[model samples]
Target chain A: MNINFTLNKKSVTIDVDPMKRLLDILREDFRLLGTKESCGEGECGACTVLLDGKPVTSCLVNAVHIDGKEVMTSEGIAKEPIGKLLIDCFDETNAVQCGFCFPGFLVTSYHYVKTDGEKNLNKIKKALSGNICRCTGYQKIFESVMLACERKPLMNANER
Target chain B: MLDINCQYKSVEVSGKKEINMKFYKPKSLLELFETSEKIEGKKYFLAGGTDINVQIKNGMIKDEPIIFLNHLTELKNILQSDNHIIIGALTSFSEILESELLKNKLPFFQNSLKNFASPLIQTTATIGGNIANGSPTADIVPLLLILDAKLKLFSKSKLREVPISEFYLGYKKFILKRNEIIGAVLIPENAETGYETFYKKIGSRKALYIAKLAIAGLKKISNNKIEEIKLAVGSLNEYPRRLFKVEEYLKNKLVNEIDFADVEHFLQKEITPITDLRSDKEYRYRVCINLIRTFLNQ
Candidate 1:
């Protein structure tokens, strides 16, 4: 089956099995290996990716189902200004340890921050509850998101 | 974040012929019904694909003749009339959680929606899938049961409305025919107001965990007497069920006059709990009784 959709910001057309997972297609077909596949099941957010601007477990998403949709992975986030701010915050808070879970955490935090997530600690915790980070016990990751939310967008400064 | 040493397998089940599976995306309910009739071999109606994807990967279901219903615009809408609010079966939990109609009307259901899997899963898991999956631990089933919801099952030519209470026959079983698909769910307008409702989900964690034991109740008290009461409990039995015996016991009884011990004994007799990986029989029974007590007291 051929799937035509946007990967990150770019349109892509590829032929693959209709039942192949979006996670495997992103990694194997497109060579966008940044999105990790930790738990083959949807339990782990390691396979998290933005499907039509909503974070979903890529491992569970069928490539055929994503036809005519948009998918944004961690690689796409890193290319954006907000994504860069998230990375810096994660670094400053020392949230990046083993780094196995960093992409999922970063993608989830980016989606949360971009979607006007409340700065309230509890709300932030709840918003990021889907993504699990074994390292740093989540406190540092929460701190990173909080710190990221505090920073003004570099793009906004240019407008000012 | 483990190494990329994982082996990627085709979506085809082993020993099954790897024929190119045809995918059908129907635009309208009529088209869907017509398409379903023309299709041959095993057919699956795909909506959110959250549960079905997992089922396919686990090889619990074969991967062929999938008719994707997510594209059906008619099936993705929510319509409210004077007597009822009709929710399309493909309506996802995220949509339900964000629906102003649901929040303003059925707040208990909206609150129950919050306790479902997670933002990711909620974005993809449809209410139809939850009911169609017929899992004992389905988060939405108990609440729907108490609300007296009805399901509209559409076949090639006709539609049949079945009260949710009678929809489930047993574990992972439903009265739905193989050729029929759930079209929409109808909630009475009264489900929105004039009733005290309670929902409690005991899960392994706050999110992304299946319900260990869950309960939902709705009651109308008039002049210190119970006018009506509906109760549904899940995860402890083969299927979530409305406790008709309990509802009968509470009818016309004064709220303050009921005995907790007697109600607990009655509840124990109503539900048969089995020890499973999520919880043990004794624990489920005790916690369920406590939940019932809490609902009554509140």
Candidate 2:
């Protein structure tokens, strides 16, 4: 099966099995390894990706289902404003202890802030609830998410 | 930031495509049946891809010739007809949760929707998949049972509506045929809403826990009396079982004069739950009893 979709503001096509998970396609085919996978059974949100600007676990989303759907991965840090801000805040807040869960965490936070502009703490926590983090206690990650929201507008300016 | 258009045609399923495997997204059910008739190895109708993908990935499902169903716009709509609330089987839980008609008319269904995995899962999970999966824990099934939901199935150029009570045969089993796809769910309109309704799911923590034991009860309250009661519990038995004996005893009981002895006695005798990996039978049973008491008190 062949699928064509936009990635990081560019269009690319790939030929693969329809049943392959979008998670593997993004990593193996597109080489966007930043999208992490933990508890591949959708129980954990470590594989979250923004599907059409909403956070969803790419592990659960099949390659066939994403036919023409837009998928944003951690590799889009420079292209996507939230990605860049999240990266900087993650570094500053020392939330990168074992960074495996960083990609899913970043994508989830990005979708949350983008969709809900106001920095409501309660909503932010709810949005990031799906993505799980292993190291660097969630307090630091939550701080980083808050910090990213603060810097997102400026970082988005860089995109212009 | 990944925004893909749906206009691009669907590609084939990922596998050793040594054979001429086809990827068919029929816009209508007729076309779907035609494709299903011709499908070769391991045919599967894809909706939401929530459980199907997971099951396939886990190797629990090794044979499924995929048939994509999200493109069937006709199956993804919700409409109200003369006497029933018609929800296309493929209509998403999120759509149902957001539907004004569903919220206003079907509170039991709405309560079940609220406990659905999360915003992300709810976005793509469909009612059809819930019934088709037939897990003892399928949230929608028990709610549908309480609401007297009916299923409309289309296959072999014929259509049939099966009442929700008789829809599932067993665990991971349904009355569907080889070429059948759930067309729509016909829930009887005018369900009484004044009844004191209860929906309680005892899962690990919250968020994504499958119900260890979930209970849904509808008790008609009139002049401080329990006029009629319908109680159903899921993840308790092979499937969600109606506690008919309990309901039978509760009927016409004065709410204020309600003796805890009668309800508890009937509840203990009605449900036969099994211990599973999710929880122990003792916990489920005790929790359900507490729920019945709490609900009655409410």
Best by lDDT: 1
Clashing pairs for predicted structure model 1, backbone only: none
> What lDDT score goes with residue A155 in model 1?
47
lDDT of 2 by residue, A13-120 (tens): 887666567888888888787877677767678777777766777877777777787777777744565666677888999987887888777777777766664556
Candidate 1 lDDT, B66-91, residue by residue in tens: 77777666778777977888899989
Steric clashes per prediction: 0, 13
Instruction: Tell me the lDDT of candidate 2.
Output: 0.75
Q: Ten consecutive residues with minimal summed lDDT in candidate 2 chain A?
A: A151-160
Chain B TM-score, candidate 2? 0.84
C-alpha DockQ of every model: 0.49, 0.29
TM-scores, all candidates, are 0.92, 0.87
- Residue B93 accuracy (lDDT) in model 2: 84
| Model 2 C-alpha lDDT per residue in residues B1-298, reported as the tens digit of each score | 1112232222234443223334566656677787788766567778888887677555665544567888677888878899789999889887898898877777667756676776667767888888787788888877777777789998867999888778777776778887887889988776646766788888776577789988887777778777778788899877777788887887887767877777778877866677889988888877887787788779
Candidate lDDT scores, in order, read 0.82, 0.75
Q: Fnat of each prediction?
A: 0.48, 0.24
